[model samples]
Target: MIAPELLSGLPSTEELPCSDDTPVDNEDQNSLPNLLLFMLASLWAERMDWYFGVDMAIYHTTGEDPRIPVVPDAFLSLGVERRKGGRSRRSYATWEENGVVPTLVLEMVSHKPGGEYGAKQEIYRQLGVLYYVIYNPEFWQRDRHQPFEVYRLVDGQYQQVFSTAEADHPYWFPEVGLGLGFRQQRLGGIEQEILVWYDAQGNPYPTPDEVQLQLRQRQQELDAERQRAESERQRAESERQRAESERQRAESERQRAEQLAQYLRSLGFDPDQLPEQ
Candidate 1:
């Protein structure tokens, strides 16, 4: 619990800077979080009770210096605003956000080492983050860990919840109702390995662009089916019209033959005695 005095002394989010003026490890480090945010916006398009931060400072009073903050590569908080009170958040202060800490945090390791497996892990544990993920795409061998790792807080400790058998995709988190997994997907017109969100059935949640593509493909299929049905209907109608025309022609020929026979009888000649034409 935070002391009342400490809470009072904590700076307002607007008064603090949004970021710490440090650069991300690489483009992937910067884009991964944003990609997740975009995907969530489409997945939960109606809900406004969540906030996902990319490289944002999370100021908590738990540490020695309340002014200092631990900035995760990405962080997610439930029961928070899509925007802070319908306004952009300058920084995430636990006290300001109704004492809500991040439920999930992610860290991506790069060429230059960040302590994702060391100090940062401990910090997230102490902050009571329910889940911590470390994505070491480039330097996993050096760290002696897999490219993707997920740890769940259990009994006041983080337990690694991944095995070699499930290395491609990890277990689902019921709290968030999403799963973290690695798959090769196209982003920004490039196909590469990416960390993606999955559902309970182990289906990856598509990006906004992918969703659009899917909708378009479905529409095209529907249109094709409609066209096929119409073509079949037209074929049936043509066959019916041909049959009707044939019947009318046969009736006209019979009428003409009866008229000729009547004329032959009037002339005192039997039409049935004539040669077949």
Candidate 2:
């Protein structure tokens, strides 16, 4: 906890640089984090006590200088306003936010290693971040690390908390009430691997596009059902009209026969006797 007296002297978030302005070596550095941010937004649309930042600066008093921010690929902070002061935050300053540090930090390893395993891990450990995730999809062999790894702060140190087993693909974080995992998906007509959020039961939450597709499929099914019912109703109506027409024809024939019999009786000839001819 930063002392109130010292906190007052620290620079505000507005005055701090949002990030180091380092260009990402690969597209995943920017795209992947934004994907996670978008997923979180959809998952926690109603919640107002969380914030997810991508390539954002996090200023803290734990470091030598509060001005030197640790810009993670992505970070999630709980117990903080979704929007600070009814507006978007310029940067996440621990002192301004009641000294609440990020709960989790994500670092995506690119072509060039960005110290994800050494320096940055130590930084997150010092900041008391509970979870640290390192995703090294393409260059894991070079770094001698797994493609995906999750570390939990245990006794002031980060310990590996995930395995490479298929059954344990999605590592659940009970503290955050969400799980992190990877799956292959097609995005923008390109098939690639992507991170996904999971429930405790290991059910992956559908993307916005998937949800919309499901809705459209359901509507089409309902329309088909309605059409089938209308066709059955029309067939029944046609059958009833045909039966009515047959009944009218029989009645007319009976009336005509009775009229012919009456005329024969009026002519003084027995119709029953003439019917044999």
Candidate 3:
């Protein structure tokens, strides 16, 4: 932890720029990170001790200047406020956050490289980050690196822990209690690749769209069940009415026979002695 006297002189997050004003080369640079952030929001809805930032500047004193920030495509800091002081964070300052560095940082390679393997890696290493992820899907051949790579800080050095070749996807991070992986999915009527979170068993968590589809399916099933029950009740009621009508017809015939017998007795005729017809 930085000394109190040293932290007192540092600039507040409000005074720092939110980012370095560098425009992304492609839409994936922004969309992918935000997708991860959204997934985390759903997965950890009940938890209030984590914060995920997308393309946000992170200020720390480990570098040559506290003012200079290293902006990752995305970063996750555990044991920190989801919202700082009941308000959205303009920027993340390590000093303001009680020296809580980000546990994980993600960098997505775009058409142009932005030092994901060299300078930024060193920066995260100096900041004591636990995990660093580099996602280079399109330009991996040019960069001579895997499309997806996960590095774990071991003995103050970042070591390659997992890659796509290992086929152990949705690699679980025991420290963070989450897994990271990618899959081919069609978004907005176009098929593309997307990174997704996974459970300890490597089951990918459903997106919000998937959740809505599941809810709709469940509702439709319930509606069908209700219709079947109503149909059964109507059929039972029809059978009961038919049975009552038959009972009434039999009773009418018995009453008519008794009346006829009474009339024959008045006329001095024995109805029982009459020949069968």
Candidate 4:
């Protein structure tokens, strides 16, 4: 129902609303990798100077009803603004975006039938995607046992990347400045999870949440250091003032004694008021 209307009206990237941003549902804990890929795709896309729309699904043109929408695990749209007005979008409606769909599509194989691997691949190919990625860590095995594979459209056919290739991290594409690879990290105390990023050659890109946490910690340290310096300065000023006051008091006493001695001498009284023992 909503699909057909959207299909007929894909908007320009500049005119797109960030509120179109949709909240991803946590269908399973295993879906964590999917979330990481979606965000990393958007970030690397921005760094590479291309604008891409990620996630969400729309009616597949070949067979599915034009009025229905299908949500993808993650997808990438090239030629879109990497960051649109400094905000992420909710959903990607193709009709509103120049009729151009993702250049790359990735699916975390959970439970899609032959229809998905076959019809879905064809839909994306027909939609002009250049590459399709599948991570079947626990599902289908082509070489008898492997978790991931990338297929590049060569002459209108899918060419799978063998398990023994240099396509690992810093997975290079001439189009994007960054590389895509699987790495280990701690998330919610979970370790060694797969992540995507730009090539450090080995350096890591900071997650949005992690960046914010670091900023907060640095600010706290700065605040404490400033307060300490202020206290030390105030203490030093007070001690100087006390020392000056004591010197003045001692000078005043000395002057008073001299004046008394002169008065006694002028009156023919003993200059010393009390005789020394």
Candidate 5:
């Protein structure tokens, strides 16, 4: 557990400097689902240009009253500005966001069987979030058997999206420009990665690390080309030096022969006539 004083030094969740009435959310780490939620929250917060909050408390009322804080792993509000003024926020209250519920919500169930399935299932339905993701991934398979399910709230009830009859990928979140997949992703240091999304063409989105890798490779190639050009310049310089040296040698030999012929002519022995001797 985080120390009380340490938590106190961190900005209070309820306080948004812009407004005295914003509510705050408390952060906690619960289960495997929590991990997925936190990771997704990080991705959205890092990449997209939208107001996003993860595992933060959400209060209904401004500073006027106490808050009903629900900390979700990830939440996004499209219409809201990506960042406020110059600072980031601690929590998001729906009432402030034009009374909007989260555009998308994902809840990973704990190991306690049907309670999460039954209780939380009803809660999400009543809350009226547009999309709710449930990741059970066989936590209660043999012992209790609450099968893994993903639900899309259509009209009022959550219509089942993934079925046992035919295995399917997670929904394609067009807004984020990717489709969710359950494949293993090494990006987040998660070995058997679950609950990941893909791009429009069904290609896996590049992780941060992969993006860096490509940049490094390109830089190396540029360096190699530069080195090759430098080597070619040096070779050309060497060839020019050799040609100049040969020219100087030939000129010196011609000058010496001319001097010798002049001396022979001065001595009254014709240089051309003495050449045979």
Candidate 6:
């Protein structure tokens, strides 16, 4: 907490810039976070307890200066208004938020290393962030780390997590009730490798387009089943009609035989004995 004297001296979030203005080195840095945001928006559209930001400044008094911020490529905070006070936030100020820090922070490694493995990790640790994710897709070889890494704050230190290759690689967060992983998915009408959310069972939550496609496919299947059922009903009805027709024909033949027998008996000629035809 900032001392009373220092609290008044701190600059408001509105006074700070939302980003550092350093140009993003690659498109993935921007697009990947957006993909996550898009998926979250679709998945949690009705919920107002979470906020996700991309390239946004997060100001806190834990640092030497409250006005200065550590801008993450993307960050998520639970138990915060989806909009700050029903308005978009210019920046996230911990003091204004009842000291609610970000639940997770992420950095996408660009052409140049951004100290994700060293300095940023420490900074996030000091900031009390629960989870830190470094996505170094292209520069993993140079950094001597995997393309994706998730670190959890354990005992005031960041601990790297490892998982076997047999299962789908996703770091599940029981606190958030979701998982983070990579998948080949299309976004903004372009197919590419992207980050996606998963469930506790390692099943990915489908994107909006995927959900729509599934709904359409399910409707088609239902229509086909209905058609098949109708065809079977028609076949059964036809069989019933044919059986009825045969029954009527037999009845008519029996009645005709009886009538001929009666006429033959009136003539004193036994029809049963005289019949060679």
Number of clashing pairs per prediction, in order = 0, 0, 0, 13, 8, 0
Best by lDDT: 3
The TM-score obtained by model 3 is 0.91
- Candidate 4 C-alpha lDDT tens digits along 4-86: 66554534434444332444433422354455555565466435445443355543343454334445566666766654445
User: Top model by TM-score, which number?
Assistant: 3
Q: For residues 1-277, what per-residue lDDT tens digits would candidate 5 score against the true structure? A: 2344534343444464323332322221233334444444556666554664555565543233424454455555666656544467666655444555666665554444434456655655666666666555555364343334556788899876753312235457665555655555455454544555466776655555556777899899999999999999999999999999999999999999999999988899887776553
- Ranked by lDDT from best down, the candidates are 3, 2, 6, 1, 4, 5
Pairs that clash in candidate 3: none
Per-residue CA lDDT of model 1 for 171-256, tens digit only, reads 68889988887777787789977777888888888877688889999999999999999999999999999999999999999999
| Clash total of candidate 1 | 0
Residue 113 miss distance in model 1 (angstroms): 1.4
Q: Which stretches of candidate 4 lie over 4 Å from their true place?
A: 1-55, 60-70, 81-95, 111-119, 140-145, 161-170, 189-194, 245-277
Q: Over the stretch 75-130, how does candidate 6's per-residue lDDT look in tens digits? A: 99999999988999988888877778999998998898888888878888999999
- RMSD in Å for model 4: 7.1
True-structure lDDT of candidate 1: 0.85
Residue runs of model 3 more than 4 Å from their true location after superposition: 165-168, 250-274
Of the candidates numbered 4 and 5, which has the greater lDDT value?
4
Sequence-dependent TM-score of model 1: 0.82
Q: In what order do the candidates fall by TM-score, top score first?
A: 3, 2, 1, 6, 5, 4
Question: Candidates' lDDT values, in order?
Answer: 0.85, 0.89, 0.90, 0.57, 0.56, 0.85
lDDT of 6: 0.85
Kindly report which residue pairs in candidate 2 clash with one another: none
- The runs of at least 3 residues in candidate 6 whose Cα sits more than 4 Å from the true structure, single-residue gaps closed, are 1-6, 163-167, 188-190, 218-277
TM-score of every model versus the real structure:
0.82, 0.87, 0.91, 0.62, 0.67, 0.76
